[model samples]
Target: MIEGGALVKNGHIQQQLNQQVPDASDWLALSLLPRLGAGRLKQWHHERRAWPQQWLEALSVPQRHYFLYLRHPQGHGQVLQPMLDWCTAESSRALLHPDHPAWPALLNELPDPPLVLWAWGNLACLEQPAIAIVGSRHPSSAGRHHAQAFARALAEAGSCIVSGMALGIDAQAHEGALSAEGATIAVVGSGLDHTYPRQHRSLQQRILNAGGLLLSEHPPATEARPAFFPRRNRIITGLSRGVLVVEAALRSGSLISARLALEQNRDVFALPGALEASLSAGCHALIRQGATLVTTPTDIIEELGGPWRASSIQGAENRPACREGGERQRAGHDPQAQRWLVLLRDGAVSLDELVLRSGCSVSDTLNALLALELAGQVVMCGNGWTLSAPSSESGAQTR
Candidate 1:
């Protein structure tokens, strides 16, 4: 991982973590070594299984000299102490070594796997089956629609949505998964604490609040830089079983992720865009290069050897907005909230009752209700939550 300028391998690292031994500190110190990238980290691990001890003695002369410099007070204070303090925030953050259950096995397939992965939010989302949806940072409305629709279908079918958390396609995908009450992982280019694109800070928090995850190779304090993004792309592709390019210009980073996906032996799926649109050029190129042309979530699930869960896919279909209080629900409102509105139409119900009726967590139910309320489709009274106004005979919910 790029966090704090170090590399961390999985197996032996896990042993040190479990023992709560000083070796863990040694691992952190090793990661802080100047210019020590994943390739050299792997080499060091192979040559000496016992790291930070025999591991140091086995280092080449230059590496050992560099390590000696970092061992000094100035170097240690500057490079390692911050990471130690950041990792100590155990409630909101964690460092994932190779052996951590949250670690993705697909990352091991990379020629240069991250030595350690820095993560914030629910770590369990890492273990779920994932599909990456990426495209231009500035997308056409149609492109945004496809990204959201496909992500929702995949998420409903029990797949975790993964993306770079960029503005256009990535944000739509994350919103789609969250709307479905599904897991999403945002692989950020900057440190967990330094949210890039600043606008997405709310989105990042929502991901955490909804039991999703935010991941970074950089440590908590690392600022976002252009160079860090390509590195972030690799992790986005690495954690996924397949990658879907919703839209991209010829020079887009989404194409970079698609290329990396192919390199990592992950399936690459691209949605066809307009013939003349520049945004479609990269996706078209990928299709020409043998990427699967996909129009729906089943194309991904089937290609990745996952079951075709018809029921789950059915749950993601869009429904019409309900007109309540003689006011139409906002356009593009979440369909999931309409399901909750149906439950609330009869009368106010307790949060527990909503959970029971909807089979969703209290957090998810509350989030849906909040969205509905914000859209003026539902009201929360002393009784609990109820439709803000009576629904038509057909019973549609706005948001």
Candidate 2:
């Protein structure tokens, strides 16, 4: 079985993906229609539940002809079949339609929510309390460090960090989260099939290995273009409780995401950089425009709180991601401690991850971890806890 977003090898796992969902194909077809862009689609969303019918009914003659063309073999093979195959290509891959339980409901608050989302890796990250860290593709060295530090801090505090998976600040933010063994999500402009920047292929795989997610709106194999990047920022902001600008020039796209966050009524946080630095311009602008100026991860968490806390917005609490856990453990340490030991068998694990993987509440996990530390069974190593010596649970022996 796929343990951590491993791509299907033989291209199997085709039986239950997207085939059973109601109106799934219709939604995918709508997303793929060449002439029907998100702007036009949003215009007909006044009816919400009935918008699909409205979209079908209001299609112009050419649009209707195009839809008909999609039904034929030639158009189906060229435009639709690849996506169909990609969705069923692996158990880790999924086409997240609105009806799919994995679909992020926060996107619905947008004026234009995607009809179908291309999701890879852990779907649970979509529902977790997320904070978006965005900024310039070219940032100062200090800017890069801040991005990584803030992301790592927030992640260790149990928030899923979101970013565009771009160079500079975005890449550092994702890396920081993975280093903490914390959850993260990358919302990219191109299709899931293509990794933009080419060099980020390893970073992408690391994210999935850490139980993170990679998301895209485009169909598989679709190449990136100049226009796709700006549009993808909306999804990045939409997925988070707030947007943090590490470093940005006034005219940069980071400002665009901050503007979108403001428009969506989501919080915007900015870090103050050197006054003479051009990279600090957009953030200064944001602060002047009333975005929160944050210096620590707590500021972001206290301001936005963690996932379980009450949110100013709805839906954050309405639907929690339900995970299927392993069989109950018996003997040795308490059930919570046992789960922790099994997970840390390979190596160290962060407190946030211990809470997440062990299915224990924050207090319980911390208290048990402390007991282990006191008993010399485990020790704090860097940002995570590791076994101090061989143990019955770990099955490791000292020479």
**Structural similarity to truth (TM-score) of each candidate:** 0.73, 0.70
Runs of candidate 1 exceeding 4 Å displacement: 1-23, 43-48, 52-54, 66-78, 307-311, 318-399
Mark the regions of model 2 whose C-alpha exceeds 4 Å error after superposition: 1-22, 37-55, 72-74, 306-399
| Cα error of candidate 2 at position 48, Å | 6.0
lDDT of 1 by residue, 128-210 (tens): 88899999889875676568767766887899999988899999899889877899999998888898899998998899999
Go through the candidates in order and give each one's C-alpha lDDT: 0.74, 0.73
Each candidate: RMSD: 11.3, 14.2
Clashes of 2: 0
Top lDDT model: 1
The true-versus-predicted C-alpha distance at residue 233 of model 2, in Å, is 0.4
